[model samples]
Target: MPIYIAIFCVLPLLAGLIPEYLVCRFTRRKWWKVLPPLAVAAITALVTAGRLSVWESDVSPVTQLLFVPGVPAAFALLGTLLGWRLWKRLWGPRVVKDRRGG
Candidate 1:
């Protein structure tokens, strides 16, 4: 169960975080911010749906609908948010010191 959570949730979160951070940091385009979570959501949904169709699953439908894909997708969005923050910290305008001591 824990392993499943790690594979499904944490992996996607990292997958979303690293690339999004790098791209946004370099490109600094607001539009590029949308890609990671969207990709993660689509991939996670498809993988979860595939798992359900192929196996004798024990998880409930509500759990399937809500948690299986939802948690990972949410993590992905979170990664995007964190990535944006990191990019801002790295590349955003710096406050220059006043040498005249005004």
Candidate 2:
């Protein structure tokens, strides 16, 4: 599989944890609130770097410009942002209410 595709497939599993971990380490906020953006940024950077590496040997400047790094980076950034937003919308405000009367 292409590196970008492989990265995309694997990112949800790996990148999903990034924001939570970062929040836990840096601040005390819960995972749901902070994870998505961090995950997306990490995935974008990784994808961009991978694309650059894959296209570094191309001879044509136009091919290099079109296929090298920018497009994948942009896609990864947008994908990550969308993924984060979806995750937030689905599970962002999950406060557990106490059932017993005080």
Q: TM-score for every candidate vs. truth?
A: 0.68, 0.37
Q: Summarize candidate 2's per-residue lDDT along 1-102 as a digit string, tens digits.
A: 777765644454344444444444455456544455555567556756665654556566556655434455455455555655665666568888899996
Query: What's the C-alpha lDDT at position 21 in model 1?
Result: 89
Query: For residue 64, what is the lDDT in candidate 1?
Result: 66
Residue ranges of candidate 2 with Cα displaced over 4 Å: 1-58, 94-102
Candidate 1 lDDT, tens digit per residue, 1-102? 999878877876787789788878777567877777677777877868775753455656667666766787788777877877888898889998889957
* Model 2: lDDT of residue 1: 70
Model 1, which residues run further than 4 Å from truth? 44-59, 96-101
lDDT of 1 at 34: 76
Top model by lDDT, which number? 1
Estimate the overall C-alpha local distance difference test score of candidate 1.
0.76
CA-only RMSD, every prediction: 3.6, 7.4
- Residue 17 C-alpha lDDT in model 1: 80
Q: After superposition, how far is residue 70 of candidate 2 from its true place, in Å?
A: 1.6
